[model samples]
Target: MKATRLNLAPWLFLAPFLGIFCLFTVWPLLRSFILALQQTYGPGTTEWVGLHNFRYLLTDPLFWTAAANTGRFTLGSLFVQLPIALGLALLLNRPGLRGRGFFRLTFFAPSLVGLPFVAMLFAPILEKRTGLINATLHRLFPIWDPEFAWMQEYVMSSLILAALWMYAGFNMVYFLAALQNVSKDLIEAAEIDGANAWQRFRHVTLPEIAPIAGFVTLLSVIGSFQMFELSYILLNNTAGPENRGLTIMMYLYQSGFVVGDLGYASAIGWVLALTLMGIALFQRWAARRYEER
Candidate 1:
């Protein structure tokens, strides 16, 4: 009875979180999954159509296009943003890096400024003909095309750049936090053993931050899959010229809301959820392996 009492308090504390999780997250996911395997019935008239929606999703050309674009975005962000953020974090994590807090705050500020604001802020800057980037390039390098339509010619690059601007700072903050937690004793010990700066970081800093890095990687992957508000607000929901910036999430919205294909959209949603779950599991496994070593 006394041991039961001891553990009861923890469960009592957990009751709220568990209740909220089931109410908001778990329930919605189950409902969505069920919706995925069924037919599209408006609001209150869902009829049984087992695996039919999934079948259509698998065979649909639009589905393939959205899936491909999502993959490209995820891989592109992983390659371009992660390395740059990590490098910046490493530099800023130095013992006496000047204005560290100021830079950190400045970088992370954009992320906190809301997604809609980011789209509004960058839309004009990426305006095909008169955008600041092209104007500056025209002045500095006359070879650059001042007439380049960002919405058409450089659509993928424009979207990726916007994503980088919005997300790099957040990742930088994550890396910085993880870097700070690295044991100074380990670094000092490595230095005393005549290790070069590169050696110390490669051996100590990287390994210690593996779990955090894994977490950020998973988040980045999931985020890439779920990207919507930015593209919708900025590109006017078209993705761009030839749908270059069209992500899967946007496609889901376009299908459900624009095309009125709720059943198909639910199918797409389930696929996305499965993909995110797989990536998360892989990251968890990788984190465990890194920690074990």
Candidate 2:
């Protein structure tokens, strides 16, 4: 009985977490999948619709638009955010850097602010007439139009900028942590072998942090796909002019709550999940191929 109790102790301690995970995450996922196959007519009224929801999804132009916007945002995140974050991490990782701690805090503080807070803060800044952005641009380039509506005309670009401001530092923290784990001896050896700064980074430091880099890339992809709050709040819960800022999550929310099409929303949710899974799997496979090479 004592041996049995000892074996069960670990599970007993894990029970709370496991229970909450199932209740919140696993169960909702399963429920969504089920609902995706049905036609929801209210809270309690639902009829089995088989795969019609998915069939509709295949031809939905709005869905495609959302997918394209999401893809653009994800690509922008990879190209923009990762490079900046990694650069900052590398810069701050240099030996004897002054005020490293302060720099890290400064970069990371934006990420600590919630999405709603960020939206609220940037709203007035991006406004057409009295906004800071337009006013500054007008001062810097007097030829430029001072009445430019950034939030509407350049919706995706604006959203990307906001996302980068919030997440670049977060990724920097990851890269910094990864950089710390790189062996100093290896870097020194590379230096002694006449490898220049860029060469050293390309071979020694990069290989050491490849795994963490991959992880950060994965996280950025996921975060881009899950982008809703910032765009929603910033765009005033609308999809912006021509639905340019309509992410898959925003579309799903509109379908689920705004339009009262829970079944269709669940189907959209499944598609998003599947898309994320596919991209993640492909990324892993590519990383494996790179490692093998």
Candidate 3:
């Protein structure tokens, strides 16, 4: 009886969490999967479609456009944004740097601002003629075009730049923490072996912080893939000219909410979920291989 009661006690403690998880997470996921297999006409109208939605998604041109744009953004975030973030973190992590706290705060401040606010702020800044970016460039270089169309032509570039501004600092925090945790002994030993600054970083600092770097990369990928609000708001709730700024999540939103095709949206959501899971699995496998090396 005592052993049974002890087991029951643990379950009793877990009951609230399990109930909440089922109600909110598990149930919603199951329902979404079911909904993905059905065609919805309205709030209450649905017809069994089986694999039809997934089949249609494969041939959808708009979906492919969104996928391409999203892939570009993800690549930009992984390569450009992450490198800059690590550089900033390295700079800030230096010992005896003046006003380190102030610099850190300044760099991280943009992340604290809400996405909507950041979108609003950068929208006018990236504008032509009267915009901050073009105006400054034109002022500095007389030959520069002040009327350059950033929002229209360079939609992905504009989105990538804005994301860099907002997220670079946030990602820097993770790198900074990882840097701090890196062993000074290993760094010093590498230096004693006549290794230069870059060599020491490559041999010691990088290996030490690799796990954190991988984590940040995963986070950036997921966030970039899920991008919607920033692009939507920056492009003024449209997909920009020629649908250049259209992202997967944005397409999902348009399908589910705007076009009243909840079934198709659910299908997109599952695709996204599966993609993320695959990426995560790949990362894990790669990490294991790297560690073995």
lDDT of 1 by residue, 35-116 (tens): 7766654555676788888887889887787788778878878999999889889888988778988988888877887777
TM-score of each: 0.89, 0.94, 0.95
- Between prediction 1 and prediction 2, the one with superior TM-score is 2
List model 2 lDDT by residue over 70-130, tens digit each: 9999998999989999999999999999999999999999999988889888888888968
lDDT score, candidate 3: 0.93
Report every candidate's CA lDDT: 0.83, 0.91, 0.93
- Specify the poorest-scoring 10-residue window by lDDT in model 3: 38-47
Task: Please tell me which model should have the higher lDDT, number 1 or number 2.
Answer: 2
Candidate order by TM-score, decreasing, is 3, 2, 1
Pairs with steric clashes in candidate 1? none
Clashing pairs in 2: none
Evaluated at residue 238, the lDDT of candidate 2 is 92
- Alpha carbon lDDT at 59, candidate 1: 90
